[model samples]
Target chain A: MNFSRVIYNKFLSSWMRISITVIILIPFAIGIALLLKSLPIIRSDSIFNLVGSGKWAPSEGKFGFRPYILSSVYVTLFSFLFAAPVSFLSAIYLTQFARGRLIKLVYPVIDILAGIPSVIYGVWGVLVIVPFISGFVAPVFNTSSSGFTILAGGIVLAVMCIPYMLNMLLEVLKTVPTGLKEATLSLGATNWETTKHVVLRNCFSGVVSSFGLGITKAFGETLAVMMVVGNTVHISFNPLQSGYPLPALIANNYGEMLSIPLYDSALMFAALLLMTIILVINLFFRFLMYRAVNQ
Target chain B: MRKRKNIEEKFFKSLSGLTTYSLIGILLFIIAVVFYKGFNALSFEMIFKPPEGGYYYGGEGGVLNAIAGSVYIAFGATLIAVFIGIPAALFINIYLNRMKKVQNLFRYLLDALWGIPSIVYGAFGFTLMLFMGLNASLLAGIITVSILITPIVVRTFDDVLCNIPKGLIEASFALGSTKTETAFKILIKQGFSGFITALLLSFGRGIGDAASVLFTAGYTDLIPRNLDEPAATLPLAIFFQLSSPIPVVRERAYAAATVLTIIILSISLVARYISGRNTFSNIK
Candidate 1:
């Protein structure tokens, strides 16, 4: 009885210590996020007015994040639109049709691609991708100097994101039980039918979550986009024009300003926005994962 | 009739085989392209000289300084991250197990932090450093990268710790070990391999990261004399040099890139080998 009591006391003390540690660490971790969110720039009286202003000059205390925000969204969306279908179809092919040595080979290649450094991707985009896009795809798209255009950036972004999406989708497809596939096949379903009805239907939530995660990743990407994004703060719907992203804007302008409160606050404000977007997407993914696992 | 069915089956199998092989062929093409373009600019002298003023040719540079900066900054950040992240993870695993709501909240925050783009962290570092009056120091870069990598380390360590069987804890307690003692002696000791993997993974990531370091660490030609000074790294060197119009600088950029790639690849290979060996030993 005494020994059991001692053990119980030890457990209780450990629990308390853990709680104290967590309480200390939680605020330290979230301080960055909170500072980003609560800074004065987002709440400034001229916030709405600044959105319409094309000027980003720090000398006069003018700060406009609209162009960078818009470009980030536009390029991210374009990249997603290109990457999603290709990756989804590739996942379909791998999960459904791949066999033996081929599956093994493809898996390692995808892993390596996922692990490749972003800077390397940036180098490749600048060296090989830009030249190729200029020489080949630019004329087809009717763009001059493909060095810094949305389409060129989007293509590079697509290549970077494909492995991530493919891996997630493949993991999701693996969860569909063998019995479901057999049952569909026995009911006179073709291979395609079995895949669509049995596999994809069962993993719809997983697929959606994967897509959400991929889009979020693409949104936060910096190095490759910075290399090819033309460094101009302009808003345009055209994929053939150069523009800036939030990350690029932050990287480009942060060091140049010495003591402009508005400029520093604006960068913090953008960081806050980026964090919020990431948080929302991750929450959605977690919710979907929970539901998928629970069901 | 059976022989005829066999022939038809063989034909379909061969057709499917061809399509599968073609898919792998496309992946290999991408790798080949990386090697082809990257190799064209490689030379021994370029890797040994400092950068000239011109695009490719003017710099009298080797990448020695940048490589040293990367290793210094990465190792410094990894040490700080491991110190903070491991404890935080341990605390989460031990205390939050019963508090599902709080645990979930912490988990969500961590996931968001992990998902945040490194550039945003770079921006955060830039703002913070400016506020602190440290203008583009290597210390600022290290802190930013440390913050960026913390979530990954915490999550990985937490996962590994949580996977440790409850029975071990119970047994340790039964033997009169204190909670802290058991945690330090048994649980962490057993999970050391996984913790090492997380450390190495974050180290590699920090070494390869360019975007966050770009604004916070700003490029400096000379080697850092102190933590307050600006520093160059392999990734930033590659970024600046590769974009230059100078042929020699571009070639040097390729050499730097090749070195960076090899460093990252070697770390990853070590991670793989360690994990593989662990699994093999476990099976025995």
Candidate 2:
């Protein structure tokens, strides 16, 4: 009857099941640990004031993080301003206007774009986007500055976000079904009329959701952004200047984080802050996704 | 008014067309620039030898150390992810198959995990390492990356297992097969191809991710001698090399990026081929 083998299988099955449950909770565990680690700083420095203050020198016992928070918000919002319109139009082109073979080519290209590593994107940005902007985009403003500016960050992030926005919007556009488009066309509407009045209208919620996801993508980017965001801690709204976001700051200073008092805790707080913002956005995206799936 | 409507439509059509083509142009431009710059520094010594001087210096070494480190950490992480992820997947798809609501929640949690950025994982990994008083090493990196990829593997495997015809599982149960046995014997075989795809995809993701291991896998010019020893990865190598003010070192950075890109591309292509048309993405 091999009773021992049966017991072993049962043990293995149950143990693995429990292990996976633990595995799934890892992010939460880390999140809670970060909150705890950041507690000293949170207790000493009020989070609101801490986040709103611009002085960030831990060596000086000052922990103002408004600059970083504002940088993140501005860059993400600016990136959305650049990405949404371009990706929206691209999605429209892909689903409604493009030929069949072109659609096939573009879809796989986008999928590959998504799979390409962020470091590669960083490298490409350092060489390509940075150069292009510094040489061309900057000259028009009569500025002679290094290439690693916030505008560079925004442009690179906008490029990185195209796949996220395009893919979701593509799905939304496709889900409009052929019959709806055909009916609109049968009414003697032009392709643009059929699309503007029908396709985009059908996916208005999806278009909004894509913008949300795109914002999240831009906000969470670290390596590519750090490479070209000039890595300065100073906060500013000007895209032409160098500024640091939270993830970029963490990636930049994590190595030396333990060297200063409460520096590690501050980094932890920044991590927690980044995760909270992203998670909130993601939760909203998930709700939208669920709605999209239902529709 | 009718003519204005036509003009407006034409205006939008051209605008969208221009933007779409330009987006494609940007992708093509990135690839072209990477290839052109990277090919200049590509050499056997660049790939085969570890750095002799320093990573940032115009050292006489290749990226062998980083390459081996990436494969090692990714392999270890994938092993852990598979060990934990497959069971989670099986639990969701097999044991709890009837619990539609619970499965949806599980899937939702995984989706959220996917949404968490890699740098945040790096931050979390760094915190854990500091708490444990552990140095950045292959083991710490492996554990961190395992957590990073586990959700991906489970989500992929769950989707794959879901696509397995229910009749087959029912048939196994109808034959008086035990729950675990039926799972191992039927679900595994039915879902084998997709399983491999999930494993390789996550492995590629683990290897390609720099932000997650940026802090956990401390850079080394030498290959890791043991699990506790720090290891370099290709992405970090590229980052350091590119950051160097020296032109030769910057050239090598391009070369390293090319290698990393090729490795990732191959892994993805292989995954696509193995999963075949069930694409898993339907498997879409």
Candidate 3:
């Protein structure tokens, strides 16, 4: 009877501990979910009403985020267009062709770049890339000021996202089994042929996911874009045109919101939109990764 | 025909090699450009003195206050996070071992938090603090940064704790030790190095972060004598000085950037060392 009692007590204690942990973690998790949900509802009246109104007046309590969202998508898409191909090519070369001390030297540089903070990138964008764009790209694109244009911002953002995509591609390439590459090569295929046929084919899903992550990161970035993108609320097809991103809009305006439910709600709604975009991208990447791994 | 194939193979191989070198070259160019711009603006006095006429006054003005504020806030946040995050991670690992679905959910939430952009975190911090009526204070900044870093620490520490050989725990239990005692003494001791590594990584991240602090800790030139007062940090000082219209302020910003970069690089190196040492010792 005593043995049975001891066994029962142990089981009860273990179950109690598990329950306590669940109790603590569940509330914190739910709070985050709740915050995400509240974002869209906050912006329904003023911001959403102004969505097709084409007017953004902060003083008059009128603001529309459609231009900001459009700018974000345009700049992020342009950045991905530039960063994706270069990063993909680089990954292919590094994983397939690089050898010995050269590989050692190259990989660490990429790692350090991956770890560098985004704020530093902001400074670099302001001081270096802004001038270069104003001097060269602005003239070609017929923009007056190059400092805060989408071209300058997109270029800097592309530079920032390159390392992210490259790193992801490298990992996926590394995971490609050695035998597959050797099998292709043994059939009289050249190194380029083997890489193009075997390695690239195998890592296609990873490359797609990496590209998605890059686009998401570019879309979500605020500081670098804020520094160079000129934060105007106008929409334009030209890359040299000035614009604001969703995150920049939230960061710049949220403090001055003056207890206005409309403004606050708009900010929250933009945040909700951004979070949803990020969540969708992350889920898509995870699905691709799982498929790749399983195959 | 065989000779031609060999020649073609050699050409493609060299092209691939060139591509790798160029990729690395781009990274080097970025570092080089930053140094080139920053080096011209660096002066010995900038490190020791404050800005005069919107420029660094070498003899008297120093980044001492900013450095002090950064260390204080970072330490404060790390202390709070360690207290909460470490135990929460342990709870997840030991107690919820049977709940795979819940564990997976927590892992996904943490990853989402990690991936959410820093600006969002800054906005969140701004809202949460203003709502709580703290305004822009050091305590507010610390609280925000602590929340920002907690997920990272929890994830790393949880991984370390969970990877500990299970037999050690079984042995302790077999000797009639309570689960709590076994966890606190044996499992924790075994994972001490990894725990320290996680702490240091979080500390480095908190110290390096500027966006989250920008709104939470409004910039004040005066030395922060209390936690209730707003203070400047290295990153914030660099940012404001760079953006300031004054030429002197611009130079000071560059100097500050150089210093900030060095500090971040050193901390990252130390973190790498700690992680490397822990993995090596674990292997042994």
Candidate 4:
């Protein structure tokens, strides 16, 4: 009877605390596991030098990651550049300006976009954006491009990233006091001036949080980019050129890693690098959030 | 000065309107393009039947195998994630209520983990599977995906739990209810809709992701028979078809995408309905 009573009371707090701690530690555990798996490659080739060289010819047995790293950075950079203005502006419109009918129609659509499978964006990217850019947009810049390129991937990512950034920005923007805008207007500030001076100023940290989330989302994106990026190891600066990014590289090579010596560890190391980057970025945002919460 | 402000307002308004409209335009374009390309290819048999020869190459079959595989893994992963997530969420808000630093630390960790790329989860899961000497099977996929989404579930559920009124908890306790009774019976009951929404959100993510399962869940022409069997998913089905050289097979990729999109759209709609209906359920 006493044992049963102890078992029953365990539900009040003790068991929940233990299990939750274990569950929350899972990602750290996974990260450690990846680090361990990649230990061989990291030990053989220092991470800095491994990513420093520009060649990754597996047949000849070199696994330099300069190209894929460059590709991931540039593609994500371009995606952020393309997505930021549109996402922030639209979020402002959605929160401060949009009215009943427009809100009813547009808001739900944005929510749907958040949940729309990555595969659809990929399919649409492969079908439309790739051909459109390669055929028309590329020539405007005097470059020959294929449907499969980083530019196409960036376009898909911009669309996918917009909904997420918008969600974050909207949440923060809505919290801006209407009275502040009203007071600014009373002081002869125009609507644009009021929003620029008051709303945007107040939501700066949240804006940072949103962009941090966007970078994380775009950086780790695999499938949508994978379908369109011409999966090549060639390291090029031009977005018009097709190349492999880190996540896509890992996805495509994991199956065949066993056939080659040390290929699996290289891929695991890349994943480790990717996870570390995301962790650092998120830490920056969490600092911002902690400030916001304390304030 | 007034004229300058007027011009700025007009310009900025137009800018915001243009970008907002572009967002709507992009969504419509994606839906239109997918439907336009895949409409003719989408048929009952195409959805209901499994591919005959091979999934990657052109074949004379439906996407039944992939559809089944996606649902099985998603449902299984969601079940596991929910069971794990709810307790973790409760623990954060309830068990650690007095320990603000610890609660914030857990939240921060979950958020960081949530940002970890799904492909990284695949890598981690593959490593785990290697240690156990397992093949790419449905079980591996479910485990990896469960890892991928559990943080997300806990974070969102924590949001709901945090909003539960303190008064409700105190009242339950004042009525001589145990902490367990107050948490599960009252707190969870009130947050039920938000909890369901969290589940739906994670489930949709699990079903939609290809990267997390690409290595862990080995693709096949046949549906997964049991947890140990290999599983094919809709995303992989569409991926294999889209990459095909054959035009007919490329069109079929759109069909597969349509199926995936429809499933996600319906799930989101249901979530909205649930959350909308339960707005008044909070303790007054």
Alpha-carbon runs more than 4 Å astray in model 4: A1-6, A11-15, B54-57, B280-284
lDDT of each: 0.73, 0.84, 0.72, 0.85
Residue-by-residue lDDT tens digits, candidate 1, A32-82: 654654367656746576655667766776776678778888888889998
What is candidate 2's lDDT per residue for A1-295, written digit by digit as tens?
3897689678867966896678678878978988998999999889998988888778997988889888888778777888899988988877667777666667667767777888888988898878888899889999886888887888888888988888877777767878989999998898898987987778678778778877988899998889988988655566888878888988888778878989988988998999999988888887787677557
Best by the DockQ measure? 4
Query: Going through the candidates in order, what is chain B's TM-score?
Result: 0.84, 0.91, 0.84, 0.95
Q: Lowest-lDDT window of 10 residues in candidate 2 chain A? A: A100-109
Answer with 1 or 3, whichever has the higher DockQ.
1
How far is B130's C-alpha from truth in model 2 (Å)?
2.9
* Per-model TM values vs. the true structure: 0.85, 0.94, 0.84, 0.96
Model 1, which residues run further than 4 Å from truth? A1-40, A43-46, A51-60, A259-261, B1-31, B40-57, B98-104, B130-135, B161-176, B279-284
RMSD of each: 5.0, 2.4, 4.8, 2.4
Error of 1 at A4 (Å): 21
Over the stretch A102-172, how does candidate 4's per-residue lDDT look in tens digits? 76677777888888888889898888989998899899999888868888888889889998888777767
Report lDDT (Cα) of residue A74, candidate 1: 89
What would the per-residue lDDT of candidate 1 be over residues B1-284, giving only the tens digit for each residue? 65665565455445545544544665565556656755776666456554545434654547767887888789888987887777667666655657867776776667667777887777667666766789787899898888878777888667678778878878987998766566667767878877887898889988999887988887776678789988888898888887788776676677678778778778877876665555332100
The TM-score-based order of candidates, best leading, equals 4, 2, 1, 3
- Clash number by candidate, in order: 15, 3, 11, 0
TM-score of 3: 0.84
Q: Which of candidates 2 and 3 reaches a greater TM-score?
A: 2
| TM-score for the B chain of model 1 | 0.84
lDDT by residue for model 3 (B10-79), tens: 8767765666677677766766766777788676765665444423443346565576667777888889
Q: Lowest-lDDT window of 10 residues in candidate 3 chain A?
A: A22-31
